[model samples]
Target: MNLARRALLEAGKLLVVLWLVSVLVFLALRLTPGDPAVLLLGPQAGRPDAAETLAQLRIEMGLDQPWIVQYGIWLGAMLTGDFGESARSGVSVTTLIVDALPPTLWLIALAVVISVPVSILAGTWAAYRGRGWFPNMVRFTSTMGVAIPAVWLGLVLIIVFAVNLSWFPSGGYVAPTEDPVGFLRHMVLPVATLSVFLSGILTRFVFAEATDVFRQDYMRTALAMGLPTRRRVFAYAARNAVLPMITIVGVQIGALIGGAVLVEAVFGLGGLGQLLLSSVLNRDYLVVQSAVLLTTVAVLLIGYVADIVYRLVDPRIAR
Candidate 1:
């Protein structure tokens, strides 16, 4: 298909996926045990008029409405950029999300900046070395890196670098505008923790792709021609190998948003992940639903961009 047609089809798929996600996010919370109305009126639940008050609150909050009606109301509000109020804090859900989004974005951006080059270099080096000890070691390390949990890694780094060494703070976030140096220092460990896992996966992927590129007939011909090592690798192998890595990297970056949630919680960054967790625990239905839907939108957009990048890398994909 042509690019326009492909894009249209992708857009349709995006809408379908988003609709499904909206339905699931709505139903899942409603099906859960706790009533948001009851949760909100905590101390008042013991009052003599508790039942009467709860019933009145439910009506006001639209909790007394049928599931379909509630879903329709929410979906309509969301389409117009109104995410409603938090059931717990009575704050606007959109405002809550907007406030929390930046720290998470910074974490993901920094992690990508640190991890990508390291992964590319390590992976390319391993591929170039073939079956040598270095390649074997890279493979082993990458495997372990992927298997390690982000939360555990964050804690270990904190104990070593933050506590014993006193090199970086244990947990917290500082906006770069307020204190550039302090912000960098605060982020180092969390960024490092996130980078390690991201690099591990990317390294393995690049190694596999570059290895296949190295084995291609053209690469063998370049070898026979005694082409300069840099030219052969960069001009021939890398160009081809990097094409596939683009899509994987894009998807991983999208996933990194979700993955950063655990790291953010561990490090106390007050990012969307932490907000979402708190909202879920507090039964802040609007906040939780909006957070999840926002995350889903981010992931889908990243994937769509990756598809576009594929067409840019190799125009054949658009066909």
Candidate 2:
């Protein structure tokens, strides 16, 4: 039950989970309906020679070969920093991802920053304030947040903030390079959209965790020692409560990336979410598969980081 062995075993298991997810995602995208070549090149419009173009596309994507061979080639190329070309744009999938990843990362980073601490604090407060009308109200709101769809929320924000108030851009990205102020203005809506959704879930977990910690023997001992409510609750209960909340948030990271597709499309923000949607629409298997794998890797990485930090906070976690 020592920490080191547990950590190693957990890490290995998480890696296996990630690998399985990647494989399935890759296969699923390829199995979807529609031909990427036709999606990209169109049906005998410019070519006026459907058969010849399809043969060329089959060769380019190795679709002319068996599934296993194609998978090997695709996976091999992927590992070597070669993402292959998009069927539609003839653009390298890796290049497109590089171009698109930053905005999505930035958006997620901002949302996380807002969600985590706020959730922890609010949850702690509610736990300490227990059974009060205010705490009950907060709990109800958190439940709603967990229930409501992020996409629906995004649309609501767009209508209220962008359309009704005559404030913020309803959709689209503004590159910081091209227009810094415009970029920020465009950022506010989507960031708020994501933050609201995340904060709700985090807050609920935090509240539950904090409440559990509040009942622990250590909290009673701290109070018996004449520690102030704030000090005892925060330094004792809050500290212990954070671990589970952290774990949940880490798990949610991957799912949020998937969730962002809807949010980004609703907001018209150009990020991996939007990119994933477009790739799906075009039936661009490589791009879609790559994006899903990338997102899954991110989730695993974050969860692993949380596990590492868990050991630091709760040294007994290893046992």
Candidate 3:
């Protein structure tokens, strides 16, 4: 009963936060410098006709309505899966998001797939052999990777793999229809760039957690029971250690999305990151709202799932 009540309370809190985010997103468009009308129109749009155009834009954009009324309309549209038309491209926001989602999913999915297993394995080994040179090397690499900004690291990879080595394309996105080989080639550097940094972050958390877990009383008991050392450490220790790592992973989902923007711009991948940049610059409210909302929802969803999984992994946690 307590656990169920707690879950319900958390869900309610999340909904409140979502509503607040909606209001903040709504207000951000009004608060930011420059008029969307002027941005869409021109610098010389101060004529009498320009005034008319601005009025029309205000109405079209729901800017003429009360703040609460406008928010209700936008929220209704969002609830109905209508994210509004893009001011820049005149396309459905959903179409843009759907088209852009695959690449980002591919990038994040591939990176996480590579990172989690590798990090877990390496972390386990390092915990088993903390004093070894290999563990020290892993520690140093993770430290350096965490310190270096992902954007800079992405540029370094581009220079080495694309510019200098001629192994991959440097700029521009290629659709699979255009050239599959060229498309994949363009993805390699950016995907790898995201993977490298994310891997570093995951590895650090895994190593730290695993090492601490190995010190527990139950872990010592498992070993004293004549179980194989690695088995005792991993099969038992991993469970306890993993709960804390779940939070780290949950938080990193947000960082990964944000990092994707920087990496995408640097690599010229036409993912949501690039779209987000264009939206912010042009004050495309719908696109901006969609981008930020999707990102927030994604991280929150990850956190929710992590909480559920953590409970399953250790039933005592729900107590």
lDDT of 3 by residue, 1-319 (tens): 4667877887887788888887888788778998787787777577776888888988887778898897788889888888989887789998988888776776777677777777787777787687979999889887777788878988898889888999988877777678888878878888778877787888888889888888888777877789997677678766556667776777788888888888888988888888888889999888899878877777787887777667666678778
Candidate 1 residue lDDT tens string, 1-319: 8887888899999999999999999999988998888889998887997999899989988999999999999999999999888878888888899999888999999998988888878888789889889999999989888999999999999999999999999988899999999999999998998888888999998899989989889889999999999888777776777787778878887668878889999999999999999888878888988899989998898888888878876977766
Model 2 lDDT per residue over 1-319, tens place: 7767777888899878977886787688777887776676775735656778777977887778887887788778878977777777779888889888877887888888988988888889999989888799879888887788888888888899899997998988888889999988988988887887788889998898888888888888887889998788788888888876667888888767877777788887789989999988988888887887777777888988887777767767755
Best by TM-score: 1
Who is ahead in lDDT, 2 or 3? 2
lDDT of 1 at 159: 96
RMSD of each: 1.2, 2.0, 2.4
- Answer with 1 or 3, whichever has the higher lDDT: 1
Query: What lDDT does candidate 1 reach at residue 191?
Result: 93
- Steric clash pairs (candidate 1): none
What is the lDDT for 87 in model 2? 75
**lDDT, each prediction:** 0.89, 0.82, 0.81
- What is candidate 2's TM-score against the reference? 0.93
For each candidate in turn, the TM-score is 0.97, 0.93, 0.90
Candidate 1 stretches greater than 4 Å from native: none
lDDT (Cα, 0-100) at 156 in candidate 1:
96
Error of 3 at 143 (Å): 1.6
